[model samples]
Target: MGERPVRRSDELVELLERYAKEDGTRETEIPGLRFIRASRITEPVHSVYEPSLCVVAQGSKEVLLGEERYQYDPASYLTASVYLPITGQIMEASPDAPYLSVQLQLDMNQILEVIQAAEQAGKPKHESGRGLVVSRLGDSLLEAVLRLVRLLDTPEDIPVLAAGFIREIIYRVLQDEQNAAMKQFALLGSRAQRIAKVIERMNREFAQPLKVEELAEEARMSASSLYSYFREVTGMSPIQYQKQLRLQEARRLLLSEGLGAADAAYQVGYESPSHFSREYTRKFGLPPGRDLQRLRETLGR
Candidate 1:
C-alpha cells in the first residue's frame, strides 16, 4: 500500500515549530510572512490587525472587534480587508501542543492585480462591507500556504519564487466565494475604501480631537452616510474607533517611553489623568501603572 499523505495542517505545525521555537511572533526570511507560537493560552491582547491572511495550524483563537466576536481554527481561515483595532486571545493551547500559525500580509496592489486579471474584473461593484472575514479553508489554499512556508527551508529559491507564491495566495483569496469585502478594500472609490481612507487619517491624527465632518468630506460621503458605512465596515462608531487608537497608543507610550500616567494621557489626548486611569483600566483590565508593571515583570525587561 502507498504511504498515507501527511495532512497539510499537520505538516504546517511541524514546520512552524521547527522554525519558531520561541513563544512569540517572529518575522521570517520570506518578506511579509510571520510565524507565531505560544505554549499556553494568553490574555486578551489589544492590537491592530492589518490586511493579511492568517491560518491557524493548531489551536483556536477568538478575536473581538467591537461587540462582534470571531473564532477560527484549522478548519477556517481569517482575513482582514483593512486595518482594525481588535482584542485577540488564544482560546486553546498548551505546552505539549502549542498554538502555531502563519500570517502573510497583503498589499492593496497585489489584491488589485488579481482582481483585474481574473474574471471578476467585470463583476458589479459593491460599496461597503465588514473588514474582517472568516471562511472555510479550501484544499487549494492550504496547499499554496504550505508551499509558501516550505520556501523558508531553501533560502536561495526565495529570491525568485516567493513573489509567485505570494501572488498565488492572494489570487486564491480573491477567488473565494465570499471575497466582496476584499474587493471593497482594493477597488478605488469603494465606500469601504473611502472609509478606510478616513481610518488612515484617524490613525495618523488620533491624538487630536476628532472632526467627523472633515473626515466625511475626505471620504466624499455625507456625515450621516459616513457614520452608517463606517459602522458597517468597522463594527464601531467613529468615536469608539478613535478611542481604541488613543488607548492603544497610550499603552505603547507608557511601556516604550516610560511616560507617567498623566504624561501619557495628555500625550494621547486625554484631558484628565483620573479619567485616563479609569478608561485604561476598563480597556486593559488594570490601571496603567499596574499593567505596565505586570508586563515588565512578564517580559523581565
Candidate 2:
C-alpha cells in the first residue's frame, strides 16, 4: 500500500479541541505537568517557564522572554531549555474556536538523561545558541506530539505509560534541525548551562538588590564577560531580566493578591512607586492600576 495519507490540519484541530475540552474544562494535572484550555485574554504575566515544550494545535500565542519574542503556531513548536521569566499572551483565540494546545513540563533529570543518550549515539557536537528557540515542526516531531496528545483519550493508561511516551516525544525533538541547541542545555559545564545557573540565581532573589560584580563572581566570569555571555544566552542584560521579574510579580500581586499599585511596587523592590508605574506602563502598555483594572474586567475577577 502507498504511504498513509498524513492527517489534515483540520483533523489535527479537531483532535486538539476534543482533548482540550476534556482536559481544559477542568484543570487536569499530569504527573509532571499541568494542562489547560484557555481563550480569554490573560494578564500581562511573567513566570519562570520550566524546561518545557508547548505545541499549539490551533490559535497563535506570543511569548516575550526578556527582549526576545517567540511565537508559535500549528506548524512550529516552542521549547525552553532553562527556567526563565517569560511574558505571554494568547494572541489568537475565539469563542468559536478557543485556544487548543498542550504543554508538557520537563524534568531536569530526564533532560540530562537524554543528553547522555544523544552523546552515546554520537550526536553532533551541540552548537552554542540561545536557551530558547522556535523551529518549524518536523513530520516525525509532529506525529510524536499527536500520539502524546492522543494518550489523553485513554486516561486510564496514562499514569502507567505516559512517561515512556513523553520520553520519545523529547527524543524526536532532539533529532530535529535545532536539536543541537537543546543538547547544549544538557551539557553541565557548557556556557549555556553556566548562563542557566546565573539565571537561577537571579530568579531566586529578584527582590534583593543586584550587583553585577556579585553575579559575575557567581558565574565565574569577569563583569564585562558576564554581561556579554548573559546577553548572548538570554538576549537581555541581567538588569533587564530582573526588571521583568519585578514587574511580572507586581502585576501578579495586584491582580491575585488585590494589592494596590503603590503597595505592590514596594513589595516587588521598587524604590519609587512612580518609577514602577512608568516601567510597568512601558512594558505592559498600561499603568499598573489601569492594567489591573482591565485584567480584572477581562478575566472577570
Candidate 3:
C-alpha cells in the first residue's frame, strides 16, 4: 500500500467525521474505542500507552518510545502490547483533510483467550520482546477493523456483535508473521511477561528508590539478564524507565495540582529541587515554571 489508501480510508473518514466531529479525542459508545481529530500538526505530547490497536484513517503519526521511533499511517497499524511511556506527534494534518484515527484498547484476557483457542503454543519468534510494533494493515485485519467501526452506527447490534468482531481482530493480528512481540507478552512466563510485571512494579512505585536486585529477584532473572531484557522490551533500563515516570508525574503535578516546583520534586521522590529542575529542563526543554506556563497556554486554546 502507499501513503494513502483509497476505498478503506474513505469509509473510515466518513464514519469518523460523523462520529467525532470535534477537534480533540472523542469517546464512543463502545468501551475502549476512541476517535481523535486534529486540524493541524502538533507538538510532541507525552503519555503512557496501554495495550491497544491504533490506526489512522487520514494522516500519519510518529510515536517515540525511549530512543526508538515507530511511524505509521493508513497503510499500517501500531499495537502496544504493554504499558509504555511514549511521545507522539501528528506529522501530517491540516484544515483541509485533518488527522483522523481510531484507538481500541485491549487487555491480556482478550489476547490470551484468542491465542489459546487458536492453539498457537509455539514460542514467539526470536528477538521479539519489544513491547511496541507496527505491522502492515493487511486485508483481513483492515476488514475486521471496519466491521468494528461500523458498529458505532448501530449500537443496538453492538452488544451481540462487538465482542466477536473484537476477537476476530485480535485473531487476525495474532496470525500475522511478525506478531511475535504480541504473542510473547500474552504467553505465561515469557520473558516479556516477566518484564511487564517489573514495569508494573516500577510504575506503581516510581517514587521509591529503584532496587535492581529486588526487581531481578521478582522477575527471576539475573541483574544482567534483567538489564538486557528490560531494555529489549522497554527500550530503556529500569532506572531510566523510573526516571521518566517520575518526571512525567512531576510535570502532571505541576500542571494539574498547582504544586510548586520543590513540592512537586519531593512528591515524586526527588531529593534535590536543583537536580530535579535540571533533569526536568533536560527532558522537557524548559524549567518547571516555564514548562507549566507553556502547557497552560497550549491547553487554554
Each model's TM-score? 0.94, 0.86, 0.96
The residue-by-residue lDDT of candidate 2 on 1-301, one tens digit each, is 1142146455567766665664243344356544456665444456768788887777888888776788897778888887777877787777776777767777756777876766633444544566677888767776776666666678887888777787878888777767567766666766666778888888888888988998888768799988887776677888988998898889989998999999999998999999999999998899988887888887777
Return the TM-score for candidate 2, rounded to 2 decimals.
0.86
Model 1: how far residue 204 lies from native, Å: 1.6
**Tens digits of lDDT, candidate 3, 227-270:** 99999888988888888889999999999899999999999999
What local lDDT does model 2 show for residue 161? 76
- What is the alpha-carbon lDDT for the whole of candidate 2? 0.75
Which residue pairs come into collision in candidate 3? Answer: none
Q: State each model's C-alpha RMSD to the native.
A: 2.2, 3.2, 1.8
* Per-structure clash totals for the candidates: 0, 0, 0
Residues 1-301, candidate 1: write the lDDT tens digits: 1122247778899999999998999999998999999999998898999989999999999999999999998889999988899999999999999998999999988888888877555445555778988998888898899999999999999999999999899988887867767877787887777888898888888999999999999999899999999998889999999899999999999999999999999999999999999999999889999999998997789
